[model samples]
Target chain A: MSRSRIAFVTGADRGLGLGITKRLLELGWDVFAGSYLADWPELTELSQKEPERLHVIPLDVASDESVQAASRAVEATSGRVDVLINNAGIATHYPRTIHEEQVEEELLQIYNVNAVGPMRMAQSFVPLLRAGAGKRMCFVSSEAGSINRSFRDNWYGYCMSKTALNRGVQCLFDELRPEGFTFRLYHPGWVRSYMSGELNTDGDLNADDAARMAVAYFLRNRYEDQGMQEEDRLVMRDWLGREWPW
Target chain B: MDQIVLITEAHHPWGRALVREFAQKGWRVMACSPVSVEMFQDAFDTDRIHIFTMDMRSRESVQQAVERIQEQTSRVDLLVCGTLSSQGKESAGIANMSADLVLEDYQANALGPIRVIEACLPLMDHGLRRIALLSDVQGSLGLGLSGAGTGYAMSKAALHMAYTMLHGDLGRKGFTFRLFEPGPEPETEVSAEAAAAYFTGSREDEERMVMLDWRGQEVPL
Candidate 1:
């Protein structure tokens, strides 16, 4: 029998990261969940359920030392990572509007966690991803970043940081497509995550459902020759697999 | 009394031309940049123009400037933002530049403008408020992987999206958001003239959410 595929997820303490981790584990993949906190009730419970298959690692996406240490720990134990999901992000900087003074420092802090965090993960985990069978790196982004369709304003920090994240993902795709690496940016659909903080989501899907769709979509489409097509190089797909404009 | 227009990054050639264009048209022009007071006086008439020391990267400085403007006048008819970092020009490939540097570029190009626009929105509630963001064609998705300066292109592209969002949200509120691509070069003489004309002309519904070249020709969104 083939060995279980290994996956690494950031911000796995709760929300979409936790959902993705649970879904991946249910699918029989050994999961390395990265979180800033060492212990969470949900994570502890999950790890207890599948002690051998699930491993929780301390990670802080905003810090270089933390990311590097996490990468080294993963390399030491797992040796290979099939799917690397850059899902760690923060939306704490709220009340973004045109009338407020430019909160440059706060915006930078958001950019560090939301945009640069993904880039850092990608760089640190590329070796493991290349060694695994599933060469996919996914970024959890949002529709607020879409320039063509974005209508809601006043999310100055989140919106711009996500846009930068999308652009960074595109650059990564362009540079790594030839090497059989597939990159995707997914808008997990508005969920009741800690990030959104109850913002007008009457019909939004829950985190688990969105996560199931993510895993299904990746499994179905990751192996196809998407690199040959120019469009796949820079697509921000919805959970249902529809492309969102960058 | 003439209407007021606030232009950020006023030290640039295009920004200077915009200042002169609005000033010549007898509009009250307030130009903000990190440059010194003597530079503003050297280039334009201090009597016709108001210059403020502002840096897009600092919240305190931007807030002070916006408050000062609010104190002077309650309305700003036209807002033109010309702030963009030179890091993209100095960097090599996207892979080589540290993520922090790229974030810096986004801060200046994308976040700075959003903050400025948000701050100036209240002052624009009375009339046909217009926002023209001076971006680049390099920001267009059509460029794809063919372009260099990945950081700049990416941030400018983010700026493009910001303007699009503003257009959608403010279109009904008498706000006209335009992405003004003045080409990659710095020859502002012709484009600035066309842009001034476009900005001064009657508000056209079709121009909302539109990306226009210096000649006022619509570019693909």
Candidate 2:
């Protein structure tokens, strides 16, 4: 029974998710890393290093059963979750376009993983979140979701799914914000990330550096949302801490 | 040659009104229903209105409806797609919300309209080339206060994003767009008939895409 704060992070096998997991562990918090890639050795290596504090979880955010099982596993080790980070997301194998002869199946799969996955995680973990002192529900979202700031013409599926993700998170905020649950919906700048089974390094920001900023924002105690104004809560902020238009 | 307008979800009052208004305005109306249009036949007595079955949820149904419309007319001047699922509006929160409900809403509210528009695009090459979609103010992040319903409102926001993408890509290619909200607003809401006037009106600037509540006011994306 460790007195350390506990966090459950999705897609924690590598990239930002793994980086967040590592940062949290360094902060002396007990973290359950949800590993989707079974063959990925980084998480297993980290678990070996910090065996007592880092609990590697087998999780598929797209499936309900996997999430439920992950929740059960967390409950057994840590009765409550102080922080729940919804960072499991998938993009199409290639940039999706409406002009593509067929993108329907690919689009729905993106929506299921990027948008609905977070909703499913929140639904399964709210009870545990309520019991924790931190009560932080953090999400790794993207600038692609910002409709007012939409810059691209192609890749409708990934961008729309992110927009949908923002709305779904807003729905959760509307309900749980009143119950004293603070949220941090973030757009981790252009960090090289893993997408469609490949590590894409085209983005300028390093994943590790982006992850450090993400962890700091996730642990931030004071925010504008904590103000008494009713209409001023639940905004999405980017890596540089600029608020995004929903 | 009379102009042609295809409207989906013709079973609803908004659908029926748009059909009648377009027909009365002398444009050929392609009214699509998810079910048999036998029940609403008397409501639309004009021969200018053509009734067909289309389930936007299914790609096959949308293609078949497009084929039927092609057989009846050479081109579609306007496409007014209304894909709204009235189920699960009471889905209180993310916990109370069902994934199936959100997916259903996504199918109807976002993907379905795109299906119909894509299927009908071939027929609009030489016509008005206007695409109108139904949306909700709740979907507008700037206007909506109740960010409560996970499915209905979220799906609408996704649809708004779809509109933005479509307009971004196609608006440059000479396709005009109008996003509409037909809801409970009293002061600024226009009549269902007036919705037809707005849809058929000459606001065909492809420079930007704007959403109007039946009243023709701009909604923030």
Candidate 3:
């Protein structure tokens, strides 16, 4: 209606990213859902229902060119961006051994997607973010990036990459906060996604539940609350409103 | 009197200080470390502390310590763990450290305490069993200055995630898990001066990069 609050969500064809896009649409925001695959059934269905509000773009966050092209297309289509959600990520089965001898190529792939992918997205979209209303960048991170609370081992690539991403986000906070940009690094409690199987087997939330909680968190995020405060980076809350350690 | 069992790593200089601080506040301390029994004799006597020789890397030692505590007390109200085997020197630079060293770092600094938590869970009271794990700001992936200390960094990062998962999984069970990054210890072997010199281009640059709290004061994490 009012030039629509344009939002760009990465990995939006499925899982939590798709859910985030759905919630944003319901809240009357124009969404440019970036998915690696263009022919996802859910994206097709959503696009058909509200073609005016939703635009599905083929985006591979791992590709620098793809991210740049996608950002340009969004800028051209919407003129300005409101929110940038770096939701695209990858995680493989936990590494079996602590040694590099045990780490396979798959681990490296996970690092590229989960860690470097977000960095690529952030680099490409900062301009569009600067052009937006709230000018906020939300990196869907995990508490796994924390060094203080680790209790187990293995999960080498995912742990290292996510940790690097978290540090990157923190550095970004240091750089961007002066410019009035809010970068929120979230630890979405083990959500059942393609990356993290159907059920947590270990008692984590389903995709829908995780998405709902994440959306709630994003909505509740205030613009005035910016920078590297502990509350900003490491707040962990579930659907039931329990605070967990970061 | 609520029974609180404070489990700390003996190798650190701050361990004695923290023990004294908690003891002054009237907590019954159960200090465990790989250090010799004679080393903590004075603190043990003055703080009314019980010192146990425990190797966190060994599950048997951890279980034994837990059993010893269980024999004396029925339930543990709080478990405050400050055990870290890897220091700044060990985790110094990514290029210098071997992958094996890195993994060992994870085991000692991260997984060791997890083993302790698992063993102690059964001994914990049903409600309000607050578990605080001592963490460092350096282990923070979001705030890490460099890729140095690959093993130490990875271990801390993994532990943070593990704690989050544990918090989510155990929230309904009435357990309160807290991951506290006490920032840099000012007067330790890994002093702020040493850390800055190792990680920064210059002392001035390092000084500029320091984080300030809400009060605009440098508060240790």
Candidate 4:
């Protein structure tokens, strides 16, 4: 049997990130779960469940020092990292607009965390990724970033931050394409995470369903042949594996 | 007949497929990229596809492409812009990344598309036309975690705002704007070897690449 892969997921304390971490552990992989808040109860329980397989660490993707510290901790313990999931994220308030009346300093906060955080994670952990068996980096992006399908007008700050993240992932893909790493910018659709006020759902999936689907996608490993083709980037597949146009 | 003009940024492996798909659908397809014809021969038919050699980062290149389109067609029915670039894993961190890298992201991801829109607006046939800009979930202000790609993220966020404002400002003129978010792709079929190559020297990164696919859900954009 293939050796169990090592995975590192940011924002694994709760929501989609937590679900993903749980699923990875269940699959027999060694997981380095990063959480901004070190004392998260869910993480405590997870570590207890699989003391050897799970390593919970403090990680703030937005902070350089924090990211470096987390990387050092991982390197000391694991020696190699097979997968890096940039899933640690936050969603401030809702119904945002670009006009001055609706804008605030909170907008910058959003950008710092959403836009810069993942890049920091990649930079800090890429060396470990290079030493792993599977050189893959996955960014938990959303279709909200797609320029081709935007029709609404209220989500100014949120929309803007996500758009930047998408662009960053594309750049990363290009930068890493020559180096031989499989980089993916993914939109986990709308799942019922804490940031979504537990209201985001696409009818068929909850957090667990979304996590399962994401893991399934990761296991398939078809990025090399397909690359980031337009159709692939914006594909909307149902729970039944049916594809939908963006 | 419903007149449609689909514009795609010609880079990456997907550009060719985009050109082919739109052309087959009978839409007037316009593909622009810095690469030579020989580079994308498989994806575009020189005779059937309207090809423009332009750098999205340059205003002149954008203007030239717009002029060529104007000469051939009086108005554009639909507009779609897809452009991408990268800085590689060696330059992943803030210390390793440069200001130019960030600017390049904005020029290519944000300004380029806006410039294209500015040029194409004159050709938009009033209320009948629709425009869509590609964006991602990563730019979510509420869900952000860290500083990943300063330039890329800032540009995308700017573009999203641009699109949102455009939707409102243009609504009076009968133009429709929409943001489409594409969920993550399954990782099983993606090549590990190719992914390894992209990592280059990071052959030992043990992190498993798992993508969370949204289960056919609509995001609240």
Please compute the TM-score of chain B alone for each predicted structure, in the order given.
0.91, 0.92, 0.78, 0.74
Scored against the true structure, residue A187 in model 4 reaches a CA lDDT of 68
List candidate 2 stretches off by more than 4 Å: A223-232, B87-89, B185-190, B204-206
Please state the error at residue B58 of candidate 1 in Å. 2.2
Write one digit per residue (lDDT tens) for candidate 1, span A122-184: 878888898899888888998877776767757767787787678777767777777888776
Query: Which of the predicted structures, 1 or 3, would earn the higher DockQ when compared with the native?
Result: 1
DockQ, computed on Cα atoms, for candidate 3? 0.09
The residue-by-residue lDDT of candidate 3 on A122-202, one tens digit each, is: 777788878888787788876655544544355655766676566556545555666777765677777767665332455
lDDT of 2 at B36: 84
DockQ of 2: 0.63
For model 1, the stretches where C-alpha displacement exceeds 4 angstroms are A1-4, A48-51, A92-108, A196-203, A222-233, B70-74, B87-94, B141-146, B215-217
Candidate 3 displacement at residue A122 in angstroms: 1.0
Of 1 and 2, the candidate ahead on lDDT is: 2
Expressed as tens digits, the lDDT of each residue in B95-189 for candidate 4 is: 47644465456567665666677667778865246675655554443333244554644565566656655766565576655454333333212
Which docking band does candidate 1 fall into?
Answer: acceptable
Model 4 agreement with the true structure over A25-97: per-residue lDDT tens digits: 8888889899876655988897998888899888887777888899999888877788998887667656644
**Clashes in predicted model 3:** 13
Question: How would you encode candidate 3's per-residue C-alpha lDDT over B1-221 as one tens digit per residue?
Answer: 74455565854666666555556557676777877777766655654577777777777888788888776667766676775656655534322544345446666766676667777777774534767666655555444445445556555655556555455445546665545444456655333223222211222332122323212234232
